[model samples]
Structure formats: C-alpha cells, structure tokens
Target: MKPKCISKLKITGTKRILQISLPSRKCKSIRVSPLESRLNTGCANSPKNSSSPLRNEQNNQKFISRYIARVLAKPEFQNKKRPIKTAATHRRTNSDGSKEPLSARNNKLSGGKSSCKNSDSDEKTIKKGLGIPNPDIQKTICRELSKKKLYKTNDTDEIIREKLIEAITLSFKTTNSAPNTSIDFYKLGKQIGNGAFGKVSLAQNRLTGHKVAIKIIDKSFIKDERTRRKIFQEVFIMKKLNHRNIIRLLEVFESNKNVMIVLEYAGGGDLLQIIKARGRLTEDECRGIFYQLIEAVKACHNMGIIHRDIKLDNILLTSDYTDIKLCDFGVSRFAKAGEKVDEQCGTPAYLAPEIIADLGYEPFYVDIWSMGVLLYAMLSASVPFKAKNLHDLHKLILRGKYDVPEYFSAEASDLLNKMLNPVPHMRISLEDMKLHAWYNGFVPENILDLSFNVTRQNEILSKMMSYGFPRDYVIQSLNLKDVNHASATYSLLDLESSYNYT
Candidate 1:
C-alpha cells in the first residue's frame, strides 16, 4: 500500500528456490526475507550457541519446504515417473527399441458405475481372474467341442452353416408367433451368474430348442434413473453392434416385474475363466484372441460407439474356444469424432488415465487404453496396474507405472506401450494397429456385422420376405437399429450370412 510493494526472484540452474518476499510498511526496508522477522524476534540466545525453539521452528520449516520443492520438481520424483521402485540394476526396453536402465531413464511420464450393470469391483474382478489354475470338467468338454467345430469351419461346411442359420431363423419365427409372449418364449434354465439386479441363466428357445443366456433383471431393484438409462443404452448399443466377435443380443423381453435379455450363449465361459483354467496363454494364442478383439473394437469404433469397459470378464469364449466374443456393452456410449465426455464410468482397473484425471476424455482413445490393459492381462495373467484400494489404484494409473513381463516379445511390448500411452492424442488407433508388426501376416478373417449391405440388401430382403416377416417392417427395424423380435430375426440371418465386415 505504501509503495506498491515489489518483489522478484531468479532461481539458479541447480534448482533451488531463493527466499522471496515483499517489503512491509513497518519494516522500513525495500525487501526482506520471510524468515528475517523470525530470526530477529526469536533469537533469545546467541545464534552461534542456540538450540532454541525459534531455531528449531526455522529448521523445521526450511526442511519441509525444501523437501516438498524437490519432490515437486525432480523428474524422477515428480508425478511418480517410475511406479514400481526397483534397484538401478533393472532395465526396461524403451519404446524406440533401445534398452535403458531404470535409473538411466530417470524420468518419463506425464498425465465406476454399478455392480449388476457391468461395474464389478476391482476385488471381485481380480478374484474372478488369474485365480483358477485349471479348467473344470465342463471347460474341458467345451474345449473338446471347440476343436471339433474348428475343423468343420471351412467352405465345404457351407451346408452346415446354412442349417445353423435355419435353426436360428426357426427359433425366432416360432417363438415370436406365440400368443401373449413375454419371457414365455424362453425356457429359463440353470443360473450361470447372479448379482443384485437378478441372475443370468442358461435358457432355451422353446420353439427351436436353441440354447441362449438370458439375463433376468428385476426392474424394482434398478431403482435409479441413471441405471435405467444405462439399461436402455446397453440395448441401444448391442443391437447396432453385430460383429463376428461380439456377442449378439438375440432379443429383449419385458414384463411387469423384469426384463429378460437373451444373448448368444458362450458355453466355454469368459476369457477370464479360460485364463484361470489354463495358466497364462502363449503369445500366439494371445495374439489369436487379441486379433479378434481388435476386429471387434474396430467394429464398435466404426459404429461410433465406445466400449468403456474392456476387461477380461466381459470376453466370452465360444463353445469350442476357437474364438472370443466381446460382450458387456452395459457401459458403452456413442461419441462423435473429437467429442470429449466428462462422465467417468468403467471398471477401476481398465479406466484410462484421462478418465481418472476427472477431465473430459475422448471415448475412443479410452477404449484403446483399456485394450492395452487386456493384452497385458492375457500375456502375464495379471493386471498391468494394481493397488490395495481405489485411491492407490488411481495413483498407479496416473503415474503410468506397470511392469512388462520378461517373456513379452519386442513387438508385443511395443504395441502394448503404444496402446497404453498416457497421452490421448498420442495413443495408437485401430487403423494404425493394422500396420503394427505384432499383427504382421495375421490376416483378418471374413469379418462381418449386421450393417445394411446394399449389394445384398435386396436379396436378403427377398429371403426374409419369404420367411413371412414383411419386407417394409424388416427394413425399418434394421435401419432404425431397433432392438426387438425383427432385429433379432435379422441378426440370426445377417450375422450368419449378410453384412460384410468391411
């Protein structure tokens, strides 16, 4: 107030803060150290001989400030650049394919929803994963079935494929034609899994005797509006998603008390189950599963959808375990190009750093990060980052701390790093993924989805019309992405025959 108090400071390259303060009127000086007054007033004993309270206070403050500044400034300490503390002897290969010591790379770095509806706790997810050392008798049976089926999945098996489609079509048409149907069309079987909302059971199409997994959700238990919208959103997304690697939503049935979602059954169980049943997967085996996953994710991205959750639990195995089906779209959302969403929702471990940062995140990039986590799990049989609690988990994620198993191939490790990059703008994309060396010579199969294939639209329409579903109604449902009996009927045919993977 007296002279518009001015102060300035210039820190040296050695990286220590210089004492700084503005002058006060009572001080009658142009400048002063913040500690100057304390030095003057509390020097009861001679400074040279003093072990006084004032001296102790001054030392304490100085020590604390310096410690904090160093922690905040040092590259190695700042933001916890190196997560897992190890001796300098350990080395990790850099992204550029060069090896560097843990100490040499001194720095680096920079950067939940519901139980029943696909937001299981980290504890539960971990417990369910990497715990089973061997597959039970049932998984072994499915494995055998899978190998047998794989041998039959060839061009010569066209008749078999047609028969399968016919079976699916007959189930849809016969069950839908039944009078006053809700869940009556399905004969619910054994409970496969259960949660607060309800149980997921093995069910049969009463008309065609096809086995499916029906998720029974009690409406009253899902009391919140957000949870209800999540249900709608899940249906909205899964209906539009018709990829060879995605679990198909056969149909939805609603009544006064519950909503039953009939989905394609994966008898071999989820990826987590298979991982537990057999120790970790070999790189080649993991690559096969991962390749299908990449295709599945591309399909989702092409449809402008973001599957926020992409962990082990949601990856189901086909009856023969020949392939995987990416399921659980309960947390998926539609995000236009470059749009950022602020809502934070997903499993704790699979969440991208930006989502944990509480900043708006590009939904598509978030999927890539989660995919990286998935690959890590498949390779090592453990999550990349883990902590005792949510808060610590967030800390680990923000620091970009994770160990690459010694067994990983250079290509596999490099691809994983690109996908898990902390910077959103720098993250590897699905298109770029096709060029990555890890996928070299790994030709993608005849990928297909439930999209409108103009070339074959007329032909398929004629075929469906032959089946008695009015051409106009079928066309409208497919175009509108409606989740109902017609859409289900279309899927049985489209996923089996129509809709190119392009």
Candidate 2:
C-alpha cells in the first residue's frame, strides 16, 4: 500500500507536503501530474479519490493517513537524502544579546551597513576590539559612519568598504602609534610674528620632530565676506604653488574659533630684518638673493597669478641665507588673459606708477616695479623714490625720479633703469629680466619647466597696451632686456634735480 507518486517530502510546522512525479527509464523522478497528462491527451475526465470505503468518512480518512505514515517509516524511505543547510542558516548571538544569522551580522558590521540605531552597539564592538580609549573620538567615528547609507553590491559598496577600512586604521593608529589626543601632535613654542590678521607661533611636531610655523587666525576678526574670501584665496593659492622658492603650506585646520595654517619655518627671518641688520648686502649676495626672487615671481606669473603686494618684508630667507621663499599671498589675485586690475594696493614705495595713478594696470607690470624697488633697497639700503607724503611719493614716481648710486655696476644700474620704467608698457618683462647681464648666466631651473595659461597671458598683454602706451614700445621693451645699447644710467644727484615725465 506504499504511495508510488511521492518523490520528495518536506515538513513545515504541523503540515507535511509531498511532491508527486512519474518514474523514468533511469529510475529518476519526472515532475508531471496525472491531471496534466490526461488533459494533454484530450481525455475529458476528472480526478477521483482511490480509497477503501468505510462506514464513517472520518474513519476512512484516518485509515489512509496511517497507511501513508507506515510507508514513510519503511527502511527504503528513511534512507533517502535531504537538502544541505545554507550559510544563512547558521545564526549567532552578538554581545548585545540579539540573535542574527552569522552571514548577515558580518555583512552588517564589516560592510558598514549598520544605521544610527545600531551605532552605539557598533561603537562598543570597535572600542572593545581596537582598544580605543577616547569615547569622544569613538563617538565621532560612529556618528560619521551612521550618516552613510546601507552598503549594497555595487560601486557604493566599495566606497563604504574603503571608508570602513580607513576608519579602523585611523582609530588604531590614533590609539597605538601616536598620542591619544590631537593636541599632543604639536608642542607650542615662542611667538615668532604677529599681524593684523593672526599671530605666528613656532611649534614642533612631536612625532616627526620637525619645527613649523603655525599661523593662528581668529575667525572672529574676519568680519566681512571680502576678507573671508581673501583668506580662502590665500590658502588656495599657496596650496597650488609647489615651487621651491615659495613657502609651502603644509596643512590647514579649522575649528569653531580659529583657523590654523601650518607653514615651513624660515629661521633666518625676512629680507627686511636682514637689510636692517647689515645696512646693505654685497653685490654677490644681492645677486644671489635677487635671482631667487626673480625665479619665484616668474613662477607666479607663469601660473597667471599676481602677488599685488611684493616687498622686502614679504620675502623670507632660510637659516643659512642660501635661498629665499616668497610668502604672504594675502593680496594675490588670478589675473586672467586681457585683464587689467585697477586695485590701488601694495606698499607706496613699491607701487607702480600706473597703480599710483589709480588707473587700471597689468598686475605683472606692478610686480616687476616692486621687484625693482626691492633690488634698489637691497643694494643701496634705501628706497629709490622716498618722500614725506603719498602725494609727493606719487609725484616722484610719476616723474621717474629714481636714482642709482655711483657704487652700482653698469649692469646693475641698467637693470634698475629698465625695471623702474615710468610707463607700465616700457617696463622690462620677467623673461627679459632673467636674461639681463646682471643675472650673468644664472638662469632659473624652473624657467622653461612651468606652463602658462596662454589665453590669460594674451588677455593681460592686450589690456595692458590699451592703457595709453604705444603697443610697439610695450612689445619692444619686454623683448629688449638683454639689449646693451639703451640709455645711460642716471646718477642719484642727476635724477634728484630733473623733473622728466617720460
């Protein structure tokens, strides 16, 4: 009385379901119901129950169920194999007393799929596993992780995986490799310099044992949007400038009250301090320092940047005075092609004649003029044009009344004359100045290595010519810094007595 149609059996709760199939030549079960085969063969007949008749219907059903149970109990039926258990069937209880499948729990915690609701438990696990002592930092990490969405089997999952790995590594390193607190990274030393915006302090990195100057700026002092934008621009520009002669901005950290900028320390102080200490530099010393300055300026100009304020105070020297790094890009601006910046900024003595006129001028021309003034101050220990008031100073600069001392060599005086040209169009360009005899084969290593935005350069040059200077003279002056046959160098007394306008 064994049922031949049942090929498989499954139990769920209190019910048992049987899979019916027909036997094939290989003795394997084929899943085809008798009703379907009869319909396909065009036999229009309904299925009939095949059970023994009894006096009571309940008794008959009970007899049929017992008969099937007896067949299932046979040795042949009991020897049949069953399906294997999957990985998801393996469940585990977390330390928090919640039961979850092992696979799902691993995916949730390791894949960063845990939400804010579960962040507390995850943080406990992280702290217990990694031994992180700082509860505040642990909370921070958990909070950041909670903000991320659940991971999926896609690109986002990879990102989440990477973030999880980074968080774990950072936490471990923070606890084991370095100090437990962020403040321990650096030790504050003496106050080095102060300005209207911030104060610079010398600090030593506890881990690397390197000294750096930290510029701490109070956020409250930046009252206006313009000033805030300038601060951002200074940081952005400093980060982009990767030249050896430009001071490196190592890192920037912002908090609720202040913004701290880590910078390379210049132990020898600024050029102004050197000038004040030594009165004037030797020709060889001046040439070496000025060459580095020219290279720095050239690098800035090539990147379409203009340091509106360039002076001795803004130039810094290394401990040995072997090199200089141009710093203080607070007034720097990106001068695009064909653009004429009309901002009347910069030191009065260093300001170009056009800038003093309150008229639009090429910023590169202004930089060159400032460099000329710097060169003069470095060699003569005095500014070329000095007056009691801004009005007299502007007048002197407009009249081209700068003087060259008798001690200056012919090449130095010639370079000064070209750089100090009254007209912005006639001022020698950085390219020609690099080739001047005063430089004496001292070509900048990065001169040709740098790239320029040609469109921006063309725009600036075109706009510069529109400012009342002959186009031909502008081009010629920019190209003729190496030309030996120009004009005789003016003496201090001669320029002081004259009142020329051109």
Best by TM-score: 1
Q: Compose the digit string of candidate 1's lDDT tens values, residues 1-502.
A: 0011112324432211112222232211112122111100000001122332222333344543453343334453334322221111111100000011111112223313321223221334322321212234323332332233322335333454354444435544554321222454455777776533566788765434556787788888667654565566666667667766788777776667887777877666665554554556567666667777777888887877777767666777665445567876654666666656655555556667766654455557788788888888778777787766655666666656688878999999988877766655555666666678887765544333445567566766776665455677677766766555555655655544543234
- lDDT per residue, candidate 2, 1-502, as tens digits? 0111111334232111111121232311111122111110000000111221311123343543454344434553335232211111111100001011111111224445421122212334323322223436544543443344324435443454354335434544444221122222345787776644666788764323456677778888787644454566566666556676777665555445776766766566666655554466556667667777777887887776777666666787655344577887755666653456544455556666665444345556678778888888888777787766645665676656666789999999988877776655455666666668887744333212224445543544454333222334334433432110000011111111221111
TM per model? 0.60, 0.55
Candidate 1 lDDT (Cα, 0 to 1)? 0.54
lDDT of 2: 0.50
